[model samples]
Target: MELLFLGTGAGMPTKERNVTSIALTMYEERGSFWMFDCGEGTQHQVLKSPLRLSKLEKLFVTHLHGDHIFGLPGLLSSRSNQGGTASLTLYGPPGIKEYIRTSMQLSQSRMNYELNIIEIQEGIVFEDEQVSVSARMLDHRIDSYGYRIEEKPKLGTLLTEKLNGLGIRPGPLFGMLKRGMDVTLEDGTRIIAADVVGPPVPGRTIVILGDTRPSEGSAALAKRADVLVHEATFAQELSDLAKEYYHSTTKEAAQTAVEAEVKALILTHISGRYAQDGAQLLEEEARSLFPNAYVAHDFWSYEIPVKSREEI
Candidate 1:
């Protein structure tokens, strides 16, 4: 799985960056993409990337701020025109469903595919055999939420040498063995998959948050995350301004990562006030404390390494 930033600017759009939107490329895992906060021009942002519009199956909106949701109507309209045939599911805090429905109705926007909207309260928002997502309210101006996504451990890999040594002769049995099934040899011998299979591969977790100040829930939601995408709307030098606006500073963003014990931290929702020339300073301030911290930009992508069961 991979993360692709569609827009990373905070507050408003600028010539250099658009508003807040992120796409989790999960086609390899589930044959679709999951979007986070469809900001203005998000569909336009997707057009600039290699993403297939038809593969957008899920959306998680953090809050109902204009910068976070202005693109929903346009994106829905475009999906209809672009022939999106798959049903879509959306999850967010309360009011998201009504907001989308009202926006589409007033704008006369039409959708060709089925849309499933979910207003999350707390606890597990989504769960399947392979993955589960939890939501918790964060300290934002509105009823905002942060999502913690955990991918379940994968089954053990098939040990070819063990199977070959037992003369198990691979065929459709390999599939069964990979699924942790036992097989019986033709010579009246029995081989169990657990006895020969490797260990379970550990899962990966990721946390993404919307606009908020430095809060304990933010750190809790991102605990031990492989990647934490957070908002750093201002430099550390502007801590006062950040607090005034109820946004985080570079130091606060990195500190959140450190406190959460995240493997990597990506700072996004940047304020356009920092000109292009000031980009390095913005990144340096965060990396100074958290060496693994990365400054996010529009279209930036990252792949979280997944180890085989044997390696894990």
Candidate 2:
């Protein structure tokens, strides 16, 4: 899986950055992508990336802030023009539905595909065989949320040599065995899947938080995450201002990552007060607390490496 940062600035668009929007691309795993927070001009940003609006399957809004959701109507309408006919689901806080509906109505835009808007609560919001997503309330000016995306554990690789020794050649039975199913051979020999299969491969966990102060909910949702994406809207010197605005500082974001034991931390939603050079300072401050912390910029992409048993 890969993360594509479309816009990383906080509150407003700057010459160096736009606003808050991220694309989590799972083309290899699910042949689709999911977006978080479509800020103004987000469609324009997506046009500049390798992502396809037609392949977008879901959009998760953190809150109803104008900077976080102003581009929703335009993006949704343009998706139809770009031949996005597949069903799309949007998850967000309560006022999201009204905002999208009113915007589309006022603009007289019609969608060709089915759009599902789900108002989320603090719990497991979506689950399938491959992945599960949960949401937790955050301490922000509004009812902001943080999302935890957990991939399901996969079955171990099939022991081809061991199976061959047992007279089980590669065939339909091999597929069954890999799926943890027992099979009976032509000679009436039964093969137990557990006896031949290796240990289960652990899945990856990612946590993305909205604009907020450092809270316990952020740490809970980010526990042991492979990647934690948190907001750092202020530097260490302006921590008091950050807290007053209900936003997090570089130090606070690093503290959250450390408390959650995350493998890596990517700080986003940077305040416009910090230009490119100032942004580097924020990263340096965060790295002082958590060595793996990084400051994300617009158009930057990061691939979350798969963890093996030995690495864990």
Candidate 3:
């Protein structure tokens, strides 16, 4: 899995960054990508990245903020025009259904594909065989939410050498062993999967939060996540302003990462007041508290590699 920042700026767009949108690309696993938020001009950002609009499978909106949902209608409309025929599911707050329906109705937009919108509440918002996504209410101006995306554990690698040593050449027996099944060979040899297979490789966990102040919900959602995407709308000096605006400061964001014991912290939703150099300062401030903190810029991408058997 990989994360690509479509826009990282807060509230409004700047020359260096746009508003808040994030893309979690799982091309290898699902042959598609999922978006976290769709800020204004987000479709433009996607055009510049390696992402394909046709491969967009789901969109999870954190709140009803304009910066978070302004690009929703545009992106959805364009997806229909861009060879995106597959059904798309959107998860958002209570007002999202009305907002999208009204926008489409007023614009007279016609889609060639199925559009599924779910007005979400706290708990597991989405779940399938491969992964599960849960949400919790966060402390923001509105009823904002933070999402926890956990990938199900994967089966371990097949012990080809061990199988070969047991006179089990590559065949249906190998396939059965890989599927964690015990099989009796043609020679009446009973082979146990656990004796030869390695331990199960642990899956990765990612936590993405919308605009919010430091709260237990954020920490709980982010607990031991491989990556925590938190908004740092202000620097340490403007912490009071951050609180007043129902946003988080660099220090506050970093502290949450530390408290949650996340492996990495990615700070986004930067205010435009921070010019190129100022944004670097925000990253530095976050790193002071959490060593693995990084500031995401527009089009920036990070890989969350799968855990190996040794790591597990």
**How do all models score by TM-score?**
0.97, 0.98, 0.98
Clashing pairs in 3: none
Per-residue lDDT of candidate 2, residues 1-312 (tens digit): 999999999989999999999999999989999999999999999999999999999999988888999989999999999989999999999989999999999989999999999999999999999999999999999999999999888788888889989988888998998899998988999999988888788888989999999898998999999999999999989989999999999999999999889999999999999996998899999999999999999999989888796644
Clash count per candidate:
0, 0, 0
Model 2 CA lDDT for position 237: 93
- For residues 1-312, could you state the per-residue lDDT of candidate 1 as single tens digits? 999999999878999889999998888789888999999999999899999778888899999999999999899889877779899899988899899999999988888899999999879999999899998888878988889989999877788998888776678888888888887877868878898788889888989998899997798899889899999999998999999888999989999999888899998999998768666788899999899988888999998878555534
Better of 1 and 3 by lDDT: 3
Candidate 2 ranges with C-alpha deviation above 4 Å: 310-312
Superposed on all Cα atoms, model 1 deviates from the true structure by an RMSD in Å of 1.4
Q: Residue 299 in candidate 1 has what lDDT?
A: 94
| Residue-wise C-alpha lDDT for candidate 3, range 116-178, written one tens digit per residue | 999999999999988999999999989999999999988888888988888778888888888
Q: Rate the local accuracy (lDDT) of all candidates.
A: 0.89, 0.94, 0.93
